[model samples]
Target: MNKLDLKVLDKQEDFFIINGKEFNIGFTNAEKERSFNRNTEEGIKELNSLKEEFGANEVIYLKQIHSDKILNYIENGKSIKDEEADAIITKEKGIIIGVFTADCVPIILVDEEKKVAAAIHSGWRGTYESITFKTIEKMKKEFSINVKNLKAYIGPHIRKCCYEVSEELKLKFIEKKTEIKKEDLFCGRNLNLEVCILDDLKKAGIQDENINSIDLCTYCSEDVKLHSYRKSQGSYGRMFSFIILR
Candidate 1:
């Protein structure tokens, strides 16, 4: 039920890049009120616009849970119900995998040769749980994706500037061997969850160069665009980081 405060990154446009493909990335500002309304026809309309921008039939969406589970599309006409997983993957061509996030990091994975892609919503819980690692592991095991050949983009989310945590959380990161310093733990009382996650990804084998981080701080700038839960008192609109195999 927690969501992000909708604030746009004026300098940051919605774009993604395939590992080796020339096809450009497309993004949606789900923070728009119309995009978040579950019962409103306008919500569906907004999705339709996304379809036009990124091909409607090719998109794949996941029901995100804070857990590390990952699902693959069967390429059938089944209802895309909310599944209790943090990530979704597919080998089906033209299917754009979608991951929702506010303050949590939204990650998109793509392997050009295999024509496979994945979307992961990595929250603090997921970071501690290593959901991103698990998703990469699944991609390697199920799709034969070579970790070295894979590429990932860390989308907009809460950064260390405003993401404060407790001593317990900081200890948790240390216990996990995160490379962040104790001083970088924002509020001086807690840990920087986002940095912890980035470190975890490196530990999990995501090459430093292969990773692209937007480096946006959601809580500091709440009035511009997009949504931030920490700044907006539990808003629901979510920005999407999605990718399709073309």
Candidate 2:
């Protein structure tokens, strides 16, 4: 498996204001052992430390099948084993919703007015199925959240500079988004997953300015110590992207 080059940074937290309410969003660093796999005792310890550090009442995780499935946590309640889904949404506060990713996009959506939050795991498959769009629609239906009041924070993932895809896969994306230029999708065999996701977010009715992307490519950022599954040749430790309502 690939290992993350972990580092401790001063500005590891991302703060957001929704409806005048402030929430702190954090992504785990590669500096420490932060995997959630129960097989590794260290991974479990690291996750516990993180929960204590954040003072979160509960940390929710999913099995992550890379589909468009979105779970409503408030309705289903917590689970002893990780649930199988690509996204999770909740209106309950003090509970942290998280998704694990190495190269796939980990996206957080917050409805400032409704105090509703969602975490989505969008790999190529999930993105292809419009998981982000589905998550937003569920939030709107369940929490009555307006699109205008939603803010999105896109976490770091593999970028076009390092993410090469098959021609067959490229054709699939083109089929879904006919308006996208062929050149934008292909960086000489690499697919720009970030662009595809941002386009989807806009099409889902999120304002351009409201979408905050970390813009860091995990495969390209060896200095900052983000994990890249491709870089490790499929052996990579997953990073957890989490958000909670306080």
Candidate 3:
């Protein structure tokens, strides 16, 4: 497949259409009126509207504890409330899986042949735990998906330009994977998260050509509409990244 093509669905929503296919992958913006907060009545209404707008038969939104736990939607079969996981996978059509992120990386994986999809929330902690690799493994075991046939999309996040980390944390990452080079972690005190994610994907049998990044940095983008915890000093709304097998 070609690189994922991004199109603005409206002022508050953006959907990514995979080249030559009808993949329903998208991420919401910081639209005040259509917030997916789920904490207030208005927020709940907006979320319901989102579901209707996208034509999702079922939506699995997780609590997201920053762990490597992967939830299988088919096995769980609805009733996804209070589920603590950073990644969610499903093979059922119309079952949209979603994860919220502000500065953390939001990744969507799709196997068109098998009609299997996954949504992952990979923060620094989740990345260190190899959530992406774990999710891929779970998908393979449950849905018999081949990594070669999977298309991975890394969405907007706090890129290396603004994702500074402590030396101790950087050392921890290197210690976890000895093969990780210094250049991969150093971008002037910032970590090149996408590089690390790409490395893990490539190691897990995903082809270099099949992986793509949106390349938009949430923290550095001039567009104030994009949410970024780092840019807003931890006072930003979460953007919902979702995918459905249509």
The TM-score leader among the candidates is 3
Shift of residue 140 alpha carbon in model 1, Å: 0.6
Candidate 3 achieves a global lDDT of 0.77
The window of 10 residues in a row where model 2 has the poorest summed lDDT is 1-10
lDDT of 3 at 226: 68
Native-referenced Cα lDDT, model 1:
0.65
lDDT (Cα, tens digit) per residue for candidate 1, span 1-246: 111122322233443333346233444443334343233476445555666766647555666768877787768856464556778887766665677677888877777777788888888888788788788888888899877777776777887766777678767766765456656644565456666666656766877777766655666654345567878788666666677676
Give me the displacement of residue 241 in model 1, in angstroms. Answer: 1.3
215: Cα error in model 3, Å = 0.9
What ordering of candidates by TM-score runs from best to worst?
3, 2, 1
Model 1 clashes, total count: 16
Off by over 4 Å in 2: 1-10, 13-20, 75-81
Estimate the TM-score of every prediction: 0.81, 0.88, 0.89
lDDT of 3 by residue, 1-246 (tens): 234334433233344333326467777766452456555586556566656877877667788888999888774455664788899888877766788888899989999988888999999999988899888988888899988899898888888889889989888877886667878767667887877787778778898888877767788776535688777777636777888777
Q: Give the TM-score of candidate 2.
A: 0.88
Q: Worst lDDT window (10 residues) for model 3?
A: 1-10
Residue 77 in model 3: lDDT? 57
The C-alpha stretches of model 3 lying farther than 4 A from their native spots are 1-22, 31-34, 75-78
Q: 1 or 2, which is superior by TM-score?
A: 2
For candidate 2, the lDDT comes to 0.75
